[model samples]
Target chain A: MKKIIFGIAFLIFFSFLIVSAINMRTFGEPAYSEMDDYFIENAQSETGANNVVTSVVFDYRGFDTLGEATVLFTAVVGVIALFRGVKK
Target chain B: MKEMSRIVKTVTNFVYGFIIIFGFYIIAHGHLTPGGGFQGGAVVGSAFALLLVSYGSLNSQKFLKKDILSLFEGFGLILFIVLGFSGLGITFFYNFLANSGGWFGNAAVIGVNPGNMNTGGVIPLMNIAVGLEVLSAFGVIVLTMASAAEFTKKKEKS
Candidate 1:
């Protein structure tokens, strides 16, 4: 019974993923607008980093970076605690 | 464990040094390049693994103890949070030293454009924090596994 429910969930997830991928293919090459040009031109200056993606991840979306780092820290602490064992 | 030849140990040591240097380079240039804290830390961790495999677990532990690694990990986390909070008034992770117009600013500068490197706000410092945490965490993982294995072996022996 559990296996059957899991199988259904997996099928639904895959179906949604496939539909999203197909929909992405239908969109034509996005037209380069002034914002795109600006991002390309001044990415280094504005973000203060050479790697554009790093700038995007850590600068423009700094809140997201904080969240991600917090998640990583939580996971690390969890793992360490798990290995260390619990004392009643 | 099987004993490796002297030639193999020498070669492996050379490779390990190369990997460690490359990882440091990646972490240092993280602001400028594709590689960053996670990638570089993994690389360094792999180099330690190579040392354990080629040399021995005992030798590996001599350099990096479990407690020391944990301390380093905690320190890195604290450093990251402190750096983040330092940007409170302006923005989260703001580079306070970016335009201080002092010797400290000049020393902290990176890239061909000194001022620009400082502009990334708290990104570089954050990268360093992440790198230290990752490297220490990975070392802890290896230590945990090795210790577990040793415990199992002792139990079997008894």
Candidate 2:
């Protein structure tokens, strides 16, 4: 009975994934791309970075990167705290 | 945990330096390449992991000191925050250096010709900062976990 239930759940999840994949927008064509168009056109001149993705990451959406750095710092702190009792 | 066989050790010794250099290259070229700090850092971190696995955690501590790695991690995060705050005269995280013809301030070619390294304002700096933080963070985590595992294994054996 558990096996049957597991199989059914897996099938349902797989079908959902397949449906989403089939129905998803075409590659490189987003549903809303006004912002992308603007970035593509202006990022080089404004940020002076050839890679638009990097400009978006480090210049335009810099707060997110800051948060990511904080998260990583916190994670390292937590790991060190957890292992404080362990001997070298 | 015992160190891996001499073959793995030899291969790792031969390969880790190149891995680290490649990772640094990716971080330095992040503004012009597909990879950025996090990805490049992960590559370097994997080199540390490779070293730890081949040398064993206890033997690896001499080089991969947790104290120094922790210091670098903190330094990287602080540097990132400082860079972010430096742009506050205009706004937080502003590209104050771009197109200014100062350090890392050359205007990038309007379209793709050949990528310029000195073109991304605070981005390259941020990439280096984040790369350092992530690489050292991973080293500390792996080193700590490996030591902890050794401790647990010894306790179980006793």
Candidate 3:
């Protein structure tokens, strides 16, 4: 019974994944990209970072990075709390 | 929780410093290169994990102090927020220093060119802040997990 249920679930999940993959847009040429053009043209002069990806991460979208840091901090806190047991 | 083989310890001693240096290089040159704070910090934290795995819980305990890791993590987060607010005259996370002819304020050429270190405004500062926080957080996580495993092992043995 368990095996049958798992097989059915797996088939359902795989079909959903395949449908999403088929629907994905073509690589590189995004459908809507006003922001991409602006960044490519002006990020270097504006942020003064030659690596545009770094400029986007650290400057244009810094709040996202900050949130990432907070996530890491929270994970550490939870791990330490869970593992505070003393060895016998 | 005991130390690994002699060969593993020997290799770890020889290789950990280089790993740490490479990670720091990635963090420092984040604006000029592909890597940034989180990526570089992960690299360094992996090195620490390598050392802990090789040297065992006892020797690792001497170096991996929970309090110190917590301190560094908190300091990094605070510094990042402070840097963000420093640009409050403009806006949060504003590149107020860019093109101002001060430190990290040089105007970059609009087209292709070699990268310069002193060119990313508050980006480098943010990178450093995020790097420290990540490095310490990773260290703390690994240390706690290992210690918990050791504790459970002892509990089972008893």
What is the iRMSD of the candidate numbered 3? 1.7
Taking every candidate in turn, the Cα RMSD to the unseen true structure, in Å, is 5.2, 3.0, 3.3
Per-residue alpha-carbon lDDT of candidate 2 for residues A1-88, written as tens digits (9 for 90 to 100): 9999999999999999999999998888788989989999999999999999999999999999999999999999999999999876
- For all candidates in order, state the fraction of native interface contacts they contain: 0.29, 0.95, 0.82
Better of 1 and 3 by TM-score: 3
Which parts of model 2 are misplaced by more than 4 Å? A1-28
Could you say which candidate leads in lDDT?
Answer: 2
**What tens-digit string does per-residue lDDT give for candidate 2 at B1-158?**
68999999999999999999999999999999999999999999999999999998878988889899999999999999999999999999998999999999999999876788999999999999999999999999999999999999999999
2 or 3: which has the higher DockQ? 2
Would you list the clashing residue pairs of candidate 1?
B95-B121
Model 2's DockQ?
Answer: 0.83
Model 1, residue B63: distance off in Å is 1.5
Model 3 agreement with the true structure over A1-88: per-residue lDDT tens digits: 9999999999999999999999999899899999999999999999999999998987888888878888888888788777665552
Instruction: Please give the interface root mean square deviation for model 2, in Å.
Output: 0.6
C-alpha DockQ for predicted model 3: 0.63
lDDT of model number 1: 0.70
User: Candidate 3, residue B14: CA error in Å?
Assistant: 0.6
- In model 2 chain B, the worst 10-residue window by lDDT is B110-119
**Which consecutive 10 residues in model 3 chain A have the weakest lDDT in total?**
A79-88
